[model samples]
Target: MPVQRGYRQACGVARGLDIVGERWSLLVVRELLLGPKRFTDLQQALPGASPNALSDRLRELADAGVLRRRQLPPPGNTRVYELTTWGHDLEPIVVALGTWALAAPPTPEQIFVSADSAMLTIRTYYVPTPDQPAQTLQIDLRDHGPAGTFTAHLTSSGAAVAHEPPEQPDAVLVTTTEALLAAFGDDDVPGLVAADAVITGDADVVRRLLSSVHVPPATDPR
Candidate 1:
């Protein structure tokens, strides 16, 4: 499909925008950052995007070589959308864009974050220290439809989160995506427990992980 719109500029940023500046385009990229997702999965994660609009964005992205569609084998013969190598390069840009937004007005209290967005937020604010111990935390978002589990590995250098579970986790936290995101801000283990979060391992590890999240002060809009 021919690119629907063009800025007709030689600038790289302008060229980039020509490819992904359309509505819902980058959001599609965000959903696939961790792994491939079927059309239904993207629909669930981005409830606001209309099916037609989403399809258009997907087609445009694929045309731009940002993502590709593939079919799985065996009992799971399903088509899923995943980011291509060039598309995966957008991770830092997406992460940095999110970090930049945190300085603006806080997100409305009523806005619910998808599981992937919540995990990306953790990746955005997580701070690594030279003395911090290496450990893995299994996060189970119980309320998320199709309930998903992710593993977070913390090290002195960085923290990495994946969609798969860890073989041996130092701590396991069971909570809703909303509650988990809230914990990142307050480091409130008791509150999470009160909210019905199940802690199967050392809660301190959870606390330390939560405490290490640093959301910079929001910028005054004056």
Candidate 2:
């Protein structure tokens, strides 16, 4: 691929923009945030982009040193793309952007998030309360089609989220995408449970986990 044009300016922000300013570049970064992905996986995660566009963006990001292509060893020897350490540093930026964007009401057109993206959104929106005791919970979230597992560790000071399941989670919650989204939309745990969402282990811990993340109302601009 031929080289793309730069901003031709000396500012740091401009330099940063020159590298990731192209459309779909950051979204590519978002797809790789959880881990490596094959080209087809990326295509599935970002269905809006054409294959050629995805390929070009990957090439651009690789050339910019934001991503690298590697081949898996032995059994699964397929080539996949992953972010470099520097690229991984973009997580905070992406999370912050998501938090900011959530304030806006979703339009009818927007739909679907990759399993990882949904987990990451939970991590991004989670806020620990001062009075709440520290706790850990595991979530086995299922969509109507696919499923994923995650763990959230919360404390009075802060909270952390991991893609893996906790060995001895204080609680485990299982729900579909629609139910989970509804929970996040209104902090409605009973509603979800009534709708067939399952809860195992300590119910209080699950409550704490759900309460930690605060999603603004649909009418709230801020």
Candidate 3:
């Protein structure tokens, strides 16, 4: 059969690339990975891209079967974009790309990353033992001791709600957004602090949380 213009030649890697090959195409997919989002949510996720372009890319993604629009049920229903089973197939590809980028990082200014991690940096709230009222909050490298890739997981009722190296996060707090995310699965928190990572959030919780979270030797600078 003849290959379609945008369709993957063998429905293999190339085809996968074809579907999400544009500048922000993969980014868009990444945002959707968190959960369903409205049009504005995606726009906010990508700071640089314009609305027209974002809309176009989303349309293309849907056409390629990478995602589909969903509607909420009777309670607090809202229109949102979500990945299909086919869309989920792209996860491995994205993760591989992340691993590759971490292996050899670029300079600081040229670095780029999604705001989700940025929020993870600033917005997340945590308590050290779930018994204390979040004392000893840390933000930026100066506040923390080392510089390296650090991953965090959320817990509730003494059970893990989320953790990294594989699972998605409400947000991923780190030093360098672009390179760090690329290096996340292989993180090292102490080294990240030693390297002067730009960190923000509940310092005490972050310190305690690290013990529970696991990062591969590479991502973690320490």
lDDT values of the candidates?
A: 0.84, 0.78, 0.53
Full candidate order by lDDT, most accurate first: 1, 2, 3
lDDT of 3 at 8: 35
Each model's Cα RMSD: 1.9, 3.1, 9.4
RMSD of 2: 3.1
In terms of lDDT, model 1 sits at: 0.84
TM-score-wise, the better of 1 and 2 is 1
Residue 127's lDDT within candidate 3 is: 29
Model number with the top TM-score: 1
Residue 161 C-alpha lDDT in model 3: 25
Kindly give the stretch of ten consecutive residues in candidate 3 with the minimal lDDT sum: 139-148
Off by over 4 Å in 1: 1-3, 107-110
**Per-residue lDDT tens digits of candidate 2, residues 1-101?**
21377778889877888888888888999888878889987887788999999999999899989999999998999999999999999999887777778
Stretches of candidate 3 off by over 4 Å are 1-11, 73-77, 115-205, 211-222
* Decoy 1 TM-score against native: 0.92
